[model samples]
Target: MAGRVAAVDCGTNSIRLLIADLVDGRLVEVDRRMTIVRLGQGVDASGAFAPEALERVFAAASDFAAVIRAAGVGRMRFVATSAARDVSNREVFRNGIEERVGIRPEIISGEEEAELSFRGATTSLDLPAPYLVTDIGGGSTELVLGDAGGVIAAESLDIGSVRLTERHVTTDPTSAVELAAITRDIDVLLDKTRVPLDEARAVVAVAGTATTVAAVALNLPEYDRDAVHRARLTADQLRDTTTWLTTSTRAARAAVHSIHPGRVDVIGAGALILQRLVDRLSVDSVLVSEHDILDGVALSLG
Candidate 1:
């Protein structure tokens, strides 16, 4: 069945939309875009969606709705993760999206989130099986161990860039105490993760955090999706980049052409999470994927 479909991934830090044509059991991209709304802003401490945050997300939803309509998408799925699951005022966020997009957003579980990430990331990769897929989002990080057949074990941890930054970051360049606090939290979550990291034959990292890191690693004068996507980055490269990001001032990070302004404040935390995972897995290199849960949701529409 050939059809035009759209998938909207409203995560903690950004809202992304993907409109694609489903033909012969594969997705052909029609449009793909992202907007940094920081929907999870203050949700960790406040335990509810902030009024300003809801407004930003609603505005993005309106824009995405227009795009979907323009593309004439026949089917669309909106999935909300992390912050949506933690917030008490979810109805406000949900009703706002439904009003603009004409479809209710599904607040998916962490396990399901991991599965979708794995599917979207591995579908186009010609890599070794038993691959470990990691999605470092704003509110949470999902670790999924799977192969060509399917997923084996997966876990979604609460340690994310926005969450960690909100909890333990105050200095300009981030003090040693702040970094240690963040690292400790990440280590604690990774320690409890049940997804056998040792079983992975290859590692594939997905979403904004991984791709942005890849862009810096490649030393791109600007953000280039083609160069970042599917690019292999060694462990040493990741470590050095992480070190530089965590130690650099906000002005220096903002000056980088590869780092998005929305991510400039928290990329260090995101990079640290990636670096810690790489060290834990002891992998020589990791393959970065631009296609992620958005692709997974689009595929599910078929």
Candidate 2:
């Protein structure tokens, strides 16, 4: 049976809504958009959602609710990751969402987040099997290893764009010390990753960080999903882009139309995280995908 469904993914830095018609196990997109709410703002240090952050997220949720109603969505799922898991006042956040959206958001585990991200990134691609899918989000990064049969292994780490930047990046253009600290943190998490990186024949990276990097690498005048999706970049290209992003001033990075304004302060750390992952992979290049956990969540509703 075909049905219209909606999935809302509220992460540390942003919240996104995806509405699609599920027909024969495929998603016909209806509406997909994201807002930078920074829901996890100050969460790493405070262990709770900031008042302003909660306000922003609630506003986004209300708007999303309106869209869902207009789309006539039959089923909807809301999932919150990373910061939601760490926050002390989760019930406040949950109740507010349920009030506006008519359903509580699930604070999913890292493993589950990894699985959803893997499903979304691999579902539409015809790439080689035994793929390593990496999703670098705002508060955490998910790495999943799997083939056609399904996920072989997955792990989610605490290293993310906003989290790392909030912790390490205090200087403009990222001082060498700050960059080194960010690198060390990312390497430490990568060291603990359970997925066998060497087993992957293809590497597909999803979510905003990877997509933004791909856009910049392609030199698109603006953020073009058509051009960024499925774009492949070699290790050298990734390294160069990563270097530029990390060394460039916030003003310079914001000037790049492809880099989101919300991500300007944290993208350097995000790029560094992607660069380290690329360095670890045996493959010469990585494929970037715009489809991620939100798509997986929609598929699950069906």
On the 0 to 100 scale, the lDDT of residue 62 in model 2 is 98
Clashing pairs in 2: none
Local distance difference test, each candidate: 0.94, 0.94
What TM-score does structure 2 among the candidates reach?
A: 0.99
Clashes of each: 0, 0
Misplaced by over 4 Å in model 2 are: none
TM-score for candidate 1, please give it: 0.99
Position 38, candidate 2: lDDT: 94
- Estimate candidate 2's alpha-carbon lDDT, on a 0 to 1 scale: 0.94
Candidate 2 residue-wise lDDT, 38-59, digit = tens: 9989988999999999999999
lDDT of 1 by residue, 112-147 (tens): 999999899889677787889999999999999988
